[model samples]
Target: KILSYLDDSGSGRVDLGMFYAVVAPLCGGHLDKRKRVAFEALLWRPVNEGGSSQITKMDAVKYIKLLRAIYIPSQGMSEMLEVHGEADDDTSSSMVTFNQFLGMYDDSEWGFGIMSTVVKLETRDRNRHGNQVCSVCRYPIIGSRFKEVKTGFSLCNQCYSEGKVPPTFKQQEEYKFREYGSEVEAMKAKCVCFSMQSHKNPIAT
Candidate 1:
């Protein structure tokens, strides 16, 4: 059944809230990118899916306000996860390639991991909010256009000079050993891994 377009009843236009709750029902995934697209299509940005109305930034903010109706504080509300908890215990006896663990954000070039084992957050500022070291290149990745990505275990940068890209976010750069986040440089970085072997205290600073 189709969701009623009631949410689309914008005060003067179809803001983000109405777009996500109403029209987005016709699409998949969360209401995030979809809402952005709708905003762009309607009035902010252009859309190829056939939309051109234009919207304002204030409108986007207002719609985001409506979303509070369905808000939940927990990112881990899964009953199964609550009951069984995380697999802190190593269950897998075998190892798998990085591709099996992460989603590929881009697919045009060679495997991002094969070329570089590290991928940084890639920012213009020198303040390393956080940086990653790929095993393939063994270089610290930190540029806007850099093909920075992460596998569950490590990050990967692209061998830009050679022109190879990792197939998935879980890859290493071309010429270095894929290393985990550099603890010294990322002085404030916190590990998110849950496996006991990976870290003594997953919540450690």
Candidate 2:
């Protein structure tokens, strides 16, 4: 079927030229070193079973099936399908080449990014607890006061507001903390000072 169409040499395997013709359009262009290595690994069947760097029809078909299964919105099959439609009918015919397959997998790495985010969230949750005291300021986390993360440590609201935390603490999350109307005057005062400083010192172009 698809293997016969892509084989080109009538040997039941897709060779280098045939492989390139199939993959080039889908990979968004030529395969780079890393992409080529990944593609070979993915389509490589055991040499003992008549497999090699050159992909057999069966292996190629399986690879294409997996590519079509990639359903991540705006990332996987949807994007690849658009490429497929534009390619020549003889080569693509509902199948992508090794590099194309790898390209689709790489695009799906956003899912992995989300998984990494989950790990970060878990670490945050494990560190968070009710009645936890700020490691830096030694003050209780209470009322409208919240804890801000520092370099492997926590800072109380007052300490954080005073810029006591280090620059490395960039991560923040949506925290449910109470707000105080009394802080409005303090916030307005800080804003006025910032405005005054900005007006006094014009930045050099």
Candidate 3:
């Protein structure tokens, strides 16, 4: 269906507007107005250069590569595929079908959460302790304002209070506090995992 939109020029190319029309549904209208502008920046190509203002199949490949770098450069494509076991065959066509693209996210528990660009509170864990540190800030968490998540990671209160924690790493709640011998005691409590939160209000990616 996206290929069909490239028919606008009858030249086997898709303009920025046409491409956006094809992808708008995937975005679910959650993109902000400013974000739309940033997208234009990503889509734009100098006409004076070899390529035209419109996007061709080759141009789309280049854009996808750049997008991959911006979004998931930390995780190599091969590593991600291996971890998720999404692609069974080692060798496949470079082109991705629409269903394949959607399936990539559908297959993972946290894939949609990361792709949606909204972080939700993770479940709490109590049984684990010691030498745990905030993944984001790399600070100590024991005997201070500390919290642990299902990931078996700890974060200090200062980082949480400062709002420095990314949504992906934020805990839903801290350990429950109990008064013991004039000191506050924190006990690890168990909580069930829940669904990801909605990003009806999108933040700039």
- The per-prediction CA RMSD against the true structure, in angstroms, equals 22.2, 16.4, 19.0
TM-score for candidate 2, please give it: 0.25
How does residue 122 of candidate 2 score in lDDT? Answer: 48
lDDT scores in order: 0.33, 0.44, 0.39
Error of 3 at 90 (Å): 22
Top candidate, metric lDDT: 2
lDDT of 3 by residue, 81-160 (tens): 33322333332224333334334334454232243443121111221234456556875453354444344444565665
Off by over 4 Å in 3: 1-29, 32-35, 47-53, 74-113, 118-205
Window of ten residues with lowest summed lDDT in model 3: 119-128
For residues 53-137, what per-residue lDDT tens digits would candidate 1 score against the true structure? Answer: 4333233322232222222213213322222232333322222222321222112231112211111222223234245543346
Sort all candidates by TM-score, best to worst: 2, 3, 1
Angstrom error at residue 95, model 3 = 14
Could you tell me which residue pairs clash in candidate 2? none
Q: How many clashing pairs does model 1 include? A: 36
Question: What does candidate 2's lDDT look like per residue over 1-205, in tens digits?
Answer: 3354444358766644334433432333233543564456544434213453444434443344333333223344443334323434454344446655544535554311232343465455434444556555676543343433122354556765665643444354332333222334335655886999998997888
Model 2 ranges with Cα > 4 A deviation? 1-31, 47-51, 71-196, 199-205
